[model samples]
Target: MLVSRQTTVHPVAAPPLQVELADAPPPGVWMNSPQGSAGTIGGVGLRLLQALSAAASIAVMASTGVFPSFSAFSYLIAAASLQCLWSLAPAFVYIYALLVKRSLLNLRAMFIFSVGDWITGTLTLSAACASAGVTIVIDNDRKICAGNLCARFMTAIGMAFISWFALAPSFLFNFVLVVTTFASLLAP
Candidate 1:
């Protein structure tokens, strides 16, 4: 008689590195990328507005030659560079969506995202104005008044409206989506 041995087989799992890489797919669809949607386009555009605002502020500061730094030009560049980070937020959001494997973003979620953009945009715009005010003060424009507060407030509100405008199309898109989603859910 011959003795027979039993054999067992186990499935091998992917290596950790491979799994990690598989989880991190590059997003190719426009839905996740800034170029795919209007909201992101607006984000990039508004970021340009902020950068220009920052640059204008730096220019004013530089023209005055009032900064007490050894290399005033360097400081101006530094200040402008700091504001340039806004240009990257849209790309960052796109990457974040990619990391989550998000292909089709929900409209309501887009609306919520717009709200976030609005908050950030308004805050940034307000800060830009305040920075301009600070620069004015630094340049010895001591004609300070309660009017400046009103001016800043108005500027922020105006900028907030622009942010709202940026969100408007996306907001409508989201509303349609939300209604459609609900309708689909309710359909027999």
Candidate 2:
């Protein structure tokens, strides 16, 4: 009688930091990949936000439920939902990105961000729609947009106002500083 033998397996070794660096072309920067771009919202915070937004969207969308007869408003709701989702993605990305890095936050900037969120809430959604599932609101009719209902144009304006007056100055100042610093690095 003969018995079969199994070969042993070994774990692969991590690339040496020096070897990894040597493969770079110019501007020898370590960790240049966007792998670290992930926002560090702890599990609890992430879950809470997801639950809250989900509940709010469902309540609002269903409250304005569309039948074949209520087609206009149905399309409107669909458009608004889409836009809100679009805006939230990048807005949340940058916001949490900064927070995770322990970046300094100004009150004015935060206020602007909130306003921007409101404004974007009106956009990134049903710019216009004829179908029930569509929610982007792009209609110019005053009757439809009464008091920022269903993604008003004023919502976009409010976002701009909040961003410029509230958050722009801080972000601009930081951007300029970074540009100047980088320029100095390349100086001959």
Highest lDDT model number: 1
lDDT of 1 by residue, 1-188 (tens): 99987698788987677344543434533323334343344444554555455455445444444333324334433544454444345445655654555544555565554555445445444554454455456334765334344344334334433433443444354455556655766999
lDDT of 2 at 78: 51
Point to the candidate with the largest TM-score: 1
lDDT of each: 0.46, 0.39
Score residue 87 of candidate 1 by CA lDDT.
Answer: 33
TM value for model 1: 0.34
Q: How many steric clashes does model 1 contain?
A: 0
Worst 10 residues of 2 by lDDT: 30-39
C-alpha positional error of residue 57 in candidate 1 after TM-score superposition, expressed in Å = 10
Model 2 accuracy (lDDT, Cα): 0.39
